[model samples]
Target: MRAARYLRLGEAYISAARGVLAAPDFEQVRLPFYGLLGHGMELALKSVAARTGWDDERLMWLGHDLDWAWRVTLSDAGFEVHGARAVGGVIRQLSRPHHAQAFRYPALLTWPLPDPRCALAAAEAYLTLVRDRHG
Candidate 1:
């Protein structure tokens, strides 16, 4: 997985999320789209980390940083920060200090379908961050 390819997938994930959210019938399709988007984002992150030869410690640090960013952004929007806390806890538990031989794609993929309002906010924020950073 090339870094550029991962970045491209990240972009596509964000785009797909935007498309799903912008549609009027999002409720009907949110689960699958969210799952796919989450999987894609997780893979993209792992891909980029692998391509960069990041040590497990670095990956764990990156996950922590992203979790912090997610928490801050969600808090700023008045959403319950517990979801971010849970995600962060999982990262702490799963990420190895040296290297993660097996990628944890399921971490984000297994998250329950978010409440519609929170999901919309999170999708918008996630997409915006991806676009601004990767675009």
Candidate 2:
């Protein structure tokens, strides 16, 4: 039940991110866009982790570390996450020390932001894979 809820929340966050990314002036909103994308992917990874027998406490402890979640989820299946390189890149970008804070605050982001559409597509693919394998 908790896993299901996490998955649903992940989907919702992705959906909201997609909507924001679809706006005309998305360049002006890069912070929220990437922040939401990173967070959504984190939740999606947590959902996969939960399906692989992670407890709620463990998920919370893992908190906001998309790289760890990604590794754990892929390792649980003993395979690479297919069709998600763009999303993976974004996760790597967000997982750097204090990167989330830098993104949330007004710091100069030196890293290139992935195209929202491409990132979202890869994220959706990952979520679909998780659903198919775990559901």
Candidate 3:
């Protein structure tokens, strides 16, 4: 299923980010790390939508809007996800056009990137919440 595919891909991106962070020239790869992180979050949100019975068209409607997807998933699930508020805040920050756009193209945006470790923690927490609730 698409949800499973997204979840797996998200996990892979998180792993890739970790690998980059462990390398000697970590500074050079900051953009790629955040890019992977943002993409992972996007995929994770889509996975949630799929879990909620959204078809492919509805999933595509979600597009790269993490904030909207996060809100809709939480509302539809009707449960408080651990670290959801904090993660949602990250999602909102990343959802801004420039920030999200940065993931795809070179941009001169100056927004602060969330700490990779903290971001991973939040993602894992949120993913766990989704699994516990849906699986």
Clashes of each: 0, 0, 0
Candidate 2 per-residue lDDT, tens place, 1-135, comes to: 777778888888888888988899988986787777777788888887787788989889887777887777778746466666766776776666223565578877777666667777877887787777665
| Count of backbone collisions within predicted model 3 | 0
After superposition, candidate 1 runs with Cα above 4 Å error: 54-111, 116-135
The candidate with the higher lDDT, 1 or 3, is 3
C-alpha positional error of residue 70 in candidate 3 after TM-score superposition, expressed in Å: 1.0
How displaced is residue 120 in candidate 2, in Å? 1.3
Candidate maximizing lDDT: 2
Of 1 and 3, the candidate ranking higher by TM-score:
3
CA lDDT, every prediction? 0.46, 0.75, 0.74
Q: Candidate 1 lDDT (Cα, whole model)? A: 0.46
Highest TM-score: give the candidate number. 3
Flag the better candidate by TM-score, 1 or 2. 2
The clash number for model 2 is: 0
What order do candidates take by lDDT, descending? 2, 3, 1
Candidate 3 residues lying further than 4 Å off, grouped into runs, are 97-99
Measured with C-alpha atoms, the lDDT of residue 102 in candidate 1 is: 27
Candidates in order, TM-scores: namely 0.45, 0.85, 0.86
Name the lDDT value of residue 103 in candidate 2: 58
